[model samples]
Each structure stands twice: as C-alpha cells, then as structure tokens.
Target: MEILSKEKNARNCKFKTRHGEIETPFFMPVATKASVKHLSSIELETIGTPAIISNSLVLYLRPGLEVIEKFKGLHNFMKFHNVIFTDSGGFQMLRPAFLIDYNEQGINFKSPFDGKKFNFTPEKSMEVQEKIGADVVMCLDNLPEYGQDYESVKDAVKLTHAWADRCIKAHKDKKQLLFGITQGSVFPALRKKSIEFFNKKEVDGLALGGLCIGESKKKMFDSIKLHAKYLRKDKVRYLMGVGSPPDIVNSVNEGIDIFDSVFPTQNARHGNLFTSKGKLHILRKEFFKDESPIDENCSCYVCKNYSRAYIQYQLKFKEGVGYKLATYHNIHYITNLMKEIRLNIKENNFKKFRKEFLSNWVTKE
Candidate 1:
C-alpha cells in the first residue's frame, strides 16, 4: 500500500493486505491445493516466505465452496496468516478433457478426487476467490499451451481479455485486489496488445501468463522483457509460473515485482537442492560419503545441522527428514536470494549483483 523506495532498476513497495503488509519484489511460494506440498504455513513463514498462492480451481472442485465457507475462508481453513493469492482456474482447464473441459461459457472439469463434474466461469471463479478471501485474486483468462497456431493464440488472447472484463464487472469488493493476466504466448505484439487492453482498464496489478509452459528459456525471457516494458510500474507486475533462481534474477532486472512457482518445493520433494553455485542432485551416490552441508554458505537449519551424506542416506531410505530438510534449504536459498536483490536495489547495486551472479550461475548450466 506504500512505496518504500524506487530504484533505477526496480520499485521497492509495501502492499497492505487483510493479512498483513507484504514487501514488493517478493516471491510467493505455490500452495496449489491450499498447501505447499510438504511444508506448512508456519514452516513457510519461518523460512521467510512473505506470501503463498492457492489455486481456485483445485479448491473449488475438491472441497467445493460449501466446505471452504464452513471455515469462513481459505485463510482460516489453511491457517496461513500471510498474504495469499488465488489463481483463476483457467490454467487447469487446459488439461485433457478427461481431467478438465473448456467451452465458450467457461471450463467444466471433473473433480480429480471424486469424479464429480464442476463448472468454473469467470464470474464463478471470482465468487470462489471471494469465498476464499485471498488478498490478491487473478481473473479467469483462457491460457493456451505453447506452440499453438497464430489464429488459436489470437482467439485465446481475445477470450482472455473478454474474461478479464467480465471478472472486473463481476467483482464486488474493491478492497480485495484483482489482477488481469496477459496471455499472448510467445507473440510480442499480442502481448503488447493485451497489456494495453488491461492498462486502459487499470486493474490493481498485471500478470504475464502462458509462458514457461513448454517454451525455450530464451523465448520465455524475451516475452518477459517485452511485456515488462508495457506494464505500469506503479502497480505490481507478477511473472507467474517462473521461479528458477536465474529466472528470478533476470525478471527482477526486468522490473518484475512479484512471482510464484513450485520449483523449489517440487524439486526438493524429488531430492534436488538449489544453491548459490547452481543446482545440486542430493540423491546421487557421490554424496553417500560426503560430509559437507548442501550449501556451505546456507544458514538454514538443514544446512547448519546436517550434511549431504546424511540427507542422501535419509532420502535413499525414504525417510521424511530428507525431504523436509531439502525443502527448508531450497526455500531458504530462494528467499535469501530475493533478500540480497532487495538489498542491492536499496544500495543501487542490483545491476552489479545481477551480472556477477549470472556469470557463475549460467556457467554451471
């Protein structure tokens, strides 16, 4: 709700939500099904996570609104007392029809849990988010997969813009922030058009969607840069579904203020760890006798008290400790990285840090 500081490269801001104030240039951990996989809300906060994202689609289908309303909202149900964002169910509708169905009216999908069919329209998505009571809610926009033909991409973009308008009209509360998603795939011009369309409407924030679905890293970065140039700097700009360390740094340099992805938690569940040097495969046999922590510089509890050998052995034997430790370390690495970026911005050295970090980080790739 307040602009703390504006850097040459980025805007450092503070957002006032019902839960609390969240600093800008923040990374929101993905809690797709109202949970961040292996981590709890308290644990997430302990690891320095300022915010979390939940999917409206998953919650709408599974427990349904009736169940969530019982708890009053997602905040009480999940017990996460921080800023929360709920994504429109548009992305999930892109799955196979057996899993989800899409139509002109909206998306119809069967509950993965009970085979019960459910419909999610733009208005319906807004209603669900209102019931969920997230601080920020995304509009239900049609998101197409990568490599679609130009005509299909054009149609999807048009539909998304229309849906955004409908969402804006349907939304009842001005206090709860709503964001318009820009969906143009890899086409820069379409992206620009989408940006202009939303810019006129003047939503609370703007999100760059439909990237990193299956595109190359170059294409993804290109799209981000192109869209970033067109977005309003005063309001927040969120780059969705992108959370790699390199990607995070690059997007920050491009002036992205918010981002959410499941990379760290998902990879940690699979025995992978991200570090300053690069990614590490902790499940490898080379760590069987290794004594060093996952990252010597990491100050997370896992890195402070455990060794790579210990984690590898635990994971090898399917112990829960390995997964929990790895998750903590990875989340810490990302949150710390963001902290360093924010500090650099305050010091006006973000460009220098970005260059130095990318040199070593990219070399490992």
Candidate 2:
C-alpha cells in the first residue's frame, strides 16, 4: 500500500487487503451482528460501499467462531465481498449492561445473549478477529465513556497502551492488517501520550477512539487536531464512531482516513433524514401533501422514485418499507459524500469544499 495523493493535511490513500484495496478517506457503515439492520448486502453493494464494520465480540457470543470458520471467513458468512473491518469489542466497555469489570486481564463482560460472564483478553480478541477473517482488525483497548473522572480516563489510557502491547504480540495473522486505537477522552496530554505510544507500535494503522461520546464538538475536534501532527503520516488514521456529515467532513480535514458509526442508520429509523438542503423530519405534517423526493439532489433509489408524501405516509403508519428506504438513502448519500471528498482531496481543493460543506449542511437540534 502506498499514499496515492496528499492535499495538505487531507489525504487520498489506498491499501490492499485480502478482499480488495480500500481507498482512504472512506466511511464504513456499522454492520454489527453481520447485518445493517433493515439493509442487506445487496443494497449495500448497490450503494457503492467500499467497506463495512462488524462487532466480532457480538458474533463470538451468538454464532461462535466455529460457524464463521466453517464458511472460510466473515466475507463468506456475511456474503459481502468487500473490505470488512472487525472491532475488538472495546466499545462494549462503555455499556453498563454488558460491562462487568476492566482490569489488566482485558475486559470482563456479561453475554447479552445468554447472561454468561466472560473474560475477554487481548489475545482472545486477536484470535476472534483472525478466525472471523476480517481484512482489518482493531486492537482491544479500554474505552472510557464520557464524564468519567480525569483519573479514570488516564487509567483507561494506560490500560489501552498495555492491551495494545499484548494485542500486538498476540496477533499473528499475516494476511490481516492490525490497527491500534488511542483513547484519552478530553485530555490533550493523555491524547498525545496515547498517540505517540501507538505511533511506535507494530500496527498497520492508528485509530482515535472514545470521542464524540457526549463531549462538546469543539473538544472532540480539539483532541483530534492536537494529536493530528503526532500521528504517523504513513499509516491510516481511523476516527471511530463518528458519522455525521459535518463531523466526517471536518475530521477528514483533520487528517482522518477511516470512520464507522451506527448514528446515521439509527437516525434514519427515527425519522431523521439527510437531504441536500438539511436533515428532514419525515413525520411532520408539512410533508403530508408535498410531492417531492426526499432530496432532489440525490439520485438514490429512494430519491429517484419515492415521493416525500409517500415516505412520510408510510413512516407515519409504521411501515417496514419506510425504515428500509430511509436507511438506504442515508447510506447512499454518505457514500457519495465520501466520493466527493476524495475527489476534492486529489484535486488539492478540499479546504475550499470543506468551507462550503460546513456552511451548507444544516443540522437541526
């Protein structure tokens, strides 16, 4: 893999994987449980999706690694023949229902499936992802949730580095690339320390985790930019769990190469729709009689055919098709947005485009 293009801090890069070569500045839809809720692999493919992320820990709890190994890997199991990334279940540490304890022995959590307690070690995480056969796997780091005390966050960052060491030693899959994550919450010093630590690790890429978890937008981007120059420029930088249109554009300018989040799909199900003009509240009576596409600028299946009145009517009536249409359109819109960003980066005019995008993309509270 080589850096394809550079537009100041923003980059356009590509790396080869077992499935295919994934271009940088890409967004991945969260396909936890091997599915993207109401959407399917076919719909995802039609959207020109370059990659998707799944929770390896969830699959391990449900179907077990035996089922995944039977089909050769996650690609065969999910039937999605593109780049697949498997998270190390570090994000699950934030959920009280699933979390049991966080110590040097990796994460201890209750099985949401069967209520069984499990001790998941960094070595176990590496093995699970290898068995799952994702093209890229993330290191198992201790993720601190929002509002945790400063000392708690600092301890989490230390544990993250320790786990990263073990994860590096445990990962032996030559065909799969490993990415390390840095977690420091809102502390710039801790963020820098975490970033510098991973900068020397054997991982193929770096990821900034634990952001956008209730922190102010200014703080989130500040933490990102503070460590932006500290990151190894040769490797990819993934900003986990940030998927808003404005955030994605801003993070790209801050030098992020990859991102994955459930926010967009979750928003789509709740009647928050992404349009060229702005986010649309589909259930509003204003669209009850209006006969317009969700976004006239969008040429997705939903926008090219379905009218706002029809979608609003279906959603108001709780139709299943409504959720699917909304999810598809959101994914399609983001997929195209990523393409536009990469194009501008290659042309060395991303900042100009970013300025326009940040001003035009209206987000209603």
Candidate 3:
C-alpha cells in the first residue's frame, strides 16, 4: 500500500493487486453473478471502475468451478480484465433461506436456486476462491443480524475468529491477497475482540463486516471509526456492504480505504438516480415531460446524450435500455465522486469536502 496523501483521518493510498492497483477511498460495484446487472464489462471499464466484487459461493454454485477454470479465471470468464475481489459468501448468512445452521465446523446452507444443502467450511471457502482466482479473497465470516443479542453476537465473533485462522491456514495462493473479516454486529466489546484478533494476524487487508445491515447510522459510523482506529493502518481497510454518497464520504473520512455494495445500481434499478444535489426520483410523473438530463451536474454519457423525458419513457415501458442508462449514470457519478475524494485528500481539503457534502446530502424520503 502506497500512502499518497492524507487529510486528517482520511488517506489516499494504492492497493496493489495481481491484476491492477486499486486506489483507496474507492467503491466497487457488486458483480455477484460475474456481471453488474445493467452494465457490461466494457461499460465498467469506460466508467473508470478499477475493481469489482463477486460472490464466490454464488459463482461456485451456478457456473461451477469447471466453467471458470475452463476460461482460466473470473477475469477471463467475465471479460473484466481489471482487479477482482471474491467475497467469501459470508454475507449469505444474513438470508434466513440460505442459512440453516452454523457451527464451529462451518456453515450449513441451502441453495435457494436448487434447494440443495451444502456444507461450506472455511477450508472449502479458501479452496473455492483460490480456484475461482480473484485478486483479493475474503475469509468466510459469521455475520450476525442487526437485532441479535450480545450473546449471539459473541458466538458469531468466536466463530469468525476460529474461521479466520482456518482460512489463513488454508489459503495457499501467494499472489492472491487474502483479507480477514471482523464481525461483531453492533457491540463495541465484541468488535474490539474481533479487531484485536485480526491485529495479530498477517492479512493483506481487514474488512469491517456486519454493519449497515439494519443498525442506526450513528452506530454504523461509530463502528467504522473503531475499526479505523484499531486496525493496522499500514494495510488496507475495507468497510463492506456500504455504498452511498453520505456514508461513503464519511467512511473515507474515518479511514476506510475500499468499499463494495449494490447500493447505487440497486437504487438506480428502483428509479432513484444519484446526483450532486440529492437523489432524484426519475420515475415521477413530473419527469415524464421534463427535458433535462438525469443530473445536470453529472457529465455521464446518459446525461450528456439522453434527457429525462427519454429515460422515463423507456423505464415506464420497462425497456431494457432504460436500466442500462440509469445504472450507467449512477456508477459514473460514484466514479467521479471517488475521483473528487482522492483529489480533495491530496489537496488537504477533504475535511472541508466532507463537511459540505454531509450538510447537503440527505437520504430521507
């Protein structure tokens, strides 16, 4: 990791990977199925995306290891020749349908697609991800849900710690960076325990999991700050499952280096277009006749070439092209936002940038 510049707690760095170098304070769109829903690999490259995160277990179940191995790896299979990160599918534990039971051995999950049960041990997760060949691979973590009690969360923390060791031991790829995940739900003492455990291990990076699920924003940010303070600053800090203008800006200020979430693309599919001022509900009747771009401030291809009237018409009819355009704009906006964040940190004005941004960015409906 090369620390380029820092303003207060926020630092700009470069995380070198086997495929490429991912700049810190960057967001990765979730390509859980080896594809970002509405965009293609070519579009992702054009949007300035350096990295993407995919669900290892999902790919393992669907295309299977045979298909990916036949194509050489995920980069070749997906035609995305940039940096790629494969999530350990720990996030799947949040879904009641997928998670039947979890113990010290591993997790017992049922595939929602095939209705088949499978045992996913830490060693198995390491083996699968290594076969899938992502530049960055995460440890299989036990993520406690938002309202779970301390005892439950403590159990999760214990399991996560044990699994982290197993994952580390099983990981054999020297080129692929293995990141350990810290899960404590919303409990500070449990979070501290998890953090303290990973502090002793030599992982390429540390990910703050089990946040932004359903907890209050205050608690979420507090956890981020806690991770920022305790996790080794030399290695990269990744705050998983967080993506939004306000949350991202604040996370960056709190020293989060990398992020991945489906927020922008998911919200775009639902008609909420991110913009400089705020989110614009593009499907509203008011926009049906409006001739302006999605966001006047946004210089994305969608905004430059298309108008609100055109997009709304296509979206209203459920046209496939509409989804592509909306996803493109939202991703482009986020890409430019990260660029601005890196620039502000380099100029030592990130403090001012965060303040002004938070003051204007509101997510309430």
- The clash count for each model shown is 2, 0, 0
lDDT of 2 by residue, 111-207 (tens): 8778999889999999999999999999998887699998998999999999999999999987899999998999888899999899898889999
Worst-scoring 10-residue span by lDDT in model 3:
356-365
TM-score, one value per model: 0.95, 0.97, 0.97
lDDT of 2 at 236: 90
Cα lDDT of model 3 by residue, 299-320, tens digit: 8899999989899888878899
In Å, residue 108's CA in model 3 sits off its true spot by 1.9
Cα shift from native, residue 315, model 3 (Å): 1.8
Supply candidate 2's per-residue lDDT for 56. Answer: 94
For candidate 2, the lDDT comes to 0.89
Model 3: colliding residue pairs? none
lDDT of each: 0.84, 0.89, 0.90
Which residue runs of candidate 3 sit more than 4 Å off their true CA positions?
A: 362-365
Question: Comparing candidate 2 with candidate 3, which one achieves the higher lDDT?
Answer: 3
Q: In model 1, what are the clashing residue pairs, if there are any?
A: 1-14, 1-15
